[model samples]
Target: MKKYYWTFIFLYAAFSTNAQVKYADSLLTAGYTQVAAVEYERVLFETQDPEVRNEAILKKAFCYKLLGQYNEAYQNLLRANLFDENDSINDRLRYESVLTAFMASKYNDSYNQYVQFKYYSKDTALVDQAKVIAVLALNEQQKWGLASELVSELNESYSLKLDTAELFAVSKRPKIRNLKKQQLATTFFPGYVLVREGQVTSGLLSFTLKSGIVFSTFYHIIDKLYFTALLSGGMYNVFYAGSTEHAIESIKVNNQKKITRFNEKVSNSLFKALETSNFLLF
Candidate 1:
């Protein structure tokens, strides 16, 4: 009976219509991501097994990440981490969880998990990669003090051939160059409020900077620039309040695109006006 199921798994995994997922492990091994994504999604529907599901999810996310769909890839990477973080499956999920978090730019998450990963494997290469990522993130976030500390802990000799001192200097360039801008951005997008039926609320409505907020912010700014006022706000609210992490966590996309667009325009205009007149004390 066990053999029968194993045979089914093997045959299904072998002959899958998704040449990508069907042959992902091999393709990944050979660095053929261009052909791996198709099989990954196919594998999603091929089996209900969590392990298989996770493998497919990671591959799919990796495909998107490589394709520059950073947001989509991050979502899938997050899902895999959430699943694998459980004590029941942490051991099996550690490698992918750590890898996905790094790919998704969730440095703190990957770094925190690395301490756990340290006890589970002897793959020095993976360790080196993880440490670099953690340092890179710290560098990006302007914690250069912490980044330098972490860098010192790493064995500089293990760096890849391409990761020379000059490249390392260039790597820290993001921190040095964008340090001011990142700090200012946090304030630029301090958050938003919830307005309904002529009433404005804050706590249940404030939409702060987050993975989801970044998506909506970019969308709204684009929409406003295009003068599609109604459509822009609607889209913004849908994404902004669609989750608790957003605003009210109750905004609907289809029902409120116009309102969302208008609200954003008004808010943006007000921000500009305030700055022009120096009415807002920053």
Candidate 2:
């Protein structure tokens, strides 16, 4: 009777695991992402089958990904214990893991994982995708030379031939090289320089106030050549804020506010750029 009882307990446990998996699948299919993740976690805990547990873990990761909980998704993928080096599922999981890193705005981590994924998988398409992502990651950090080198490598890769439009689209987005030339223009028109460097507000206020006040004082001495050649630069040409140099200089005594605002805009832009297909090539 005791032997029979043990057998019944084993059978019930197996049934429970199977039921849990079924329920998780149903929930996932129904778009109940968070609850599905919980059910998958339960299957991972209850199942003795390694295959079942592995599948459960992957599904849980997918659930997290669907919910936009990228860090959690990445953690779940890390918990996957695949021993087979050539396992096809490993390739998929690795890609997904890299994707989660990208979604989380962990570009450095994503770039590293993408490189490893390319090395391990040797999938030409995946490799090309990884290269573009790496370029974007470096571009985000303002590493222009490295990003440019990667772009050149991408242009040579055959895999990118099929994705020509997207390749060109992403390639053109990095403006670091242009930024260097922009810095030099600061001497000609500091306002334009600031605006071009993502310090739009500061640039506008500073250039407008300074140029306007300068004009008021030297309006009689200032010639068309000086104004047309320097002050009439592209940056000043675009934004014309109504104020005086003295007013702007008074505020500029402490530049922390402008710096903070610029940083915030840059941070927002970084996340916005990541949401594009260019970042999530997978």
Candidate 3:
């Protein structure tokens, strides 16, 4: 009797149609967390099969969250909620995504998610988790008063894992922050100019338009992020870089009216082409 029952149990567990629970667990054990997440997502698509879809999805969101892919987790949680908005689990998942986003220092994203889901989750564990995480996230975003209130709430919550002392330590810990990249500006002013990284490129000088001699030429972008301005240097000295767009170049027209007008038309065409290109860096 015992042998028969053991065999029966083994077979039942193996032949189960709900593969998500087993697959996700197996993948996690095998260190394929991302693969587990994918398996769970597939289970979510099969509506009739309700074995462990929620569990699987939670696992998936967790995997993404652990891997520091907060955006991916946030999207998955959002999709899962669309299927069953009332699922407290989805609310919890939203809160989890918010925490991950906070840890990742994506303050704007985290704050937005927190605001959307804070009212829905009633679980003490999840609520405390969110409050604690959100306070720090808000602090990172320079919201001091709100953080203090959140911290105060956490301190008074009986279900909180830590007391006020631990809260201080957790809040003080450093999170991985987003690095801001410095973007170089591209400005052609009203005519042909050379742009380069770190320093201005060569060939901007000696570009002369004869007085009353209008001429147009398409200056090729020698490289990426470079600008070729077909400009009538009449009055304006366009400034676009960090601080100074000074009236650097002095413009003069040499006697040659008809030729200068033709130049203007050609330069205009080139400028249009450059504008259409995506290579122009902001």
Q: Give lDDT tens digits, candidate 2, residues 27-97.
A: 76676878988998998788777656766776787777667688988778877765545355566567666
Residue 185, candidate 2: Cα error in Å is 17
Summing lDDT over every window of 10 consecutive residues in candidate 1, give the lowest-scoring window: 190-199
How close to the true structure is residue 222 of candidate 1, measured as C-alpha lDDT? Answer: 70
TM-score: model 2 vs. ground truth: 0.51
Better of 2 and 3 by TM-score: 2
lDDT score at residue 44, model 2, on the 0-100 scale: 76
Q: Tally clashing residue pairs in candidate 2.
A: 1
What clash pairs does model 2 have?
A: 209-245
| Number of clashes found in candidate 1 | 11
Cα RMSD of predicted structure 3: 20.0
Deviation of model 3 at 162, angstroms: 14
